[model samples]
Target: MRVLTVNAGSSSLKLRLLGPNDEVERSTDAEPGVDLEEVLRAWPAPEAVGHRVVHGGTRFTEPIVIDTGVRKELEDLTALAPLHQPKSLAGLDAVTAQLPEVPAVACFDTAFHTTIPQAAATYAVPGEWRERYAIRRYGFHGLSHAWCSARVARFTGARRIVTAHLGAGASLAAVLDGRSVDTTMGFTPLEGLVMATRSGSVDPGLVLWLEEHEGLSPREVAETLEKRSGLAALAGKADMREVLAAAGRGDAGAVLALDVYVHRLAAGIASMAAAAGGIEALAFTGGVGEHTPEIRARAAERLAFLGLAVDPARNDTNEGEITAAGAAVRTLVVPAREDLEIARGTRAALR
Candidate 1:
């Protein structure tokens, strides 16, 4: 079955046609408003369509055929993931309209994390609040994590690994035997390791203090953390390349930002290892993970305790394996491939 996968970002739309066995027949990158006919004109008609929905909340845990009810539920979830949910819904609408009769599936990024135990998924708050709000950790970047887990297993033959999806938005996953036991992202993408623009985990007390003492409103706090903070707030920009450039020039703010970024990243990786009992390997994906050699080296140096030394030579290259020959635990670099996983899920849901 050929599956056309749609991943709509804030400014761009990515389309992929995956063959029955997951081979990419063709792909395209177009502006967000491009017509669906243009995306499909170059390829044969797809048997199905899979969309990358960022949030499913608690109700939808698996890929399901997109129907009227599913669309309504997704619309309801818009507030939960204000950044990505609307774009995903818009992508779904485009594909559904273009191929009205095609079987469409909603492959959620949160679906792969449904396996997290309640202890890890639950927020430490009042039962009343938890029950009333359905507040809990719903991990993000799960499709990337799932793809890393599967690909790393095939490459390293390890049952337990910490998979880091580091990019503009970053998260780590503890995968045991191909299942997600625990992950870094929680309730929202804003809670986890340091990201490009968003501040990761911040104390609840600090948030309350901002609202009460600093006289910042709830909306102000959200906007600050989600957009104004992180590397951007620390240095002057959010782009990792620019941050690194400034850091290289001995800029104190950039230097401090890099240190804090790597520190939180190493801590998250170690936390994930603990969640999996012990780490047999570590897998890196996403833009930063696959490209930033310095970030990987810094992280691996801090994690030397786990014997995860990266071979400087291998780390410089793009091949999957990056671990030193004698390191106890392997380190790998896996490029982001959420669309492939989306295709796999869509096929499974229909088959």
Candidate 2:
């Protein structure tokens, strides 16, 4: 079935028209401020519409055909993923408005990681709070991670893999036997490896102390952490390209920012490898993961204990396998394909 996949990120809104076999027939991107409804109205309605929703909370574990009730439920989830959920909701709304008769499916970013074991999902909070608030790690970037793991399996046939989706937002997924055993992102996107702007895994006590002593409002703290922190706060730029350039110029803060980013990313990779006992293959994906050879080489250097080695020549060429032949663990560069995953989920939901 033809599926129109809607992927709205914090920076851009992309729409892809996929053929029956998931071949991209047409694709277009719009700025964050463009009217998504107009974009949908202009394109021919496909057999189904697939939206890349970032969070599904506990209610949505799989792709669901959209309706008023489901839309309401997703609306309620906006509080969970303030940055992504709204854009996803908007995409759904646009589809419903432009193609009222067409079936639309909500493919969640948290769906793949639903396989994460309970031990990893649970948070160390009060029983009442845990139960009442649904306080647990709900890993994000499921679409990217899911696609990466599948591709890794096809390429190297590795049953145990660590898939890192490093982009403006980053996360690491521990996949074993093609299932997510654990992931770095927890509760929300803000809980894992340092992202472009989001401060990942800050001490709760420190934030509370700052609020109590410095008189910072709750909203202010959230804004700062979500938008003003991470590589941006350290290097005065959130885009890794700028940071890398400045670091190349011997800017101390930029150099430190690059160092910290790589450090946290390498640590996250190791942590995920431990989740699955060991990693047979390491896959790098998403924007920075697939394109930045330096980041990949640096991370692999640190993860040498896992027998991961990056062949500099292959890494520079951005080939399939960047790892040296006969390395215990193969390292790969898998391009992110959330659009195809969304289309697949939407087709399944239609069935």
TM-score of 2: 0.96
User: Candidate 2: how large is its RMSD?
Assistant: 1.5
**Positional deviation of 74 in candidate 2, in angstroms?**
1.1
Candidate of highest TM-score: 1
**lDDT tens readout by residue for model 1, 104-135:** 99999998899999989998889998888778
lDDT, candidate 2, at 102: 86
Task: Give the poorly placed runs of model 2, Cα more than 4 Å off.
Answer: 32-44
To one decimal, what is the Cα RMSD in angstroms of model 1 from the true structure? 1.3
TM-score of every candidate relative to the true structure: 0.97, 0.96
lDDT of each: 0.91, 0.89
Supply candidate 2's per-residue lDDT for 83: 72
- Residue 62 in model 1: lDDT: 86
Q: Give residue 268's lDDT in candidate 1 (0 to 100).
A: 94
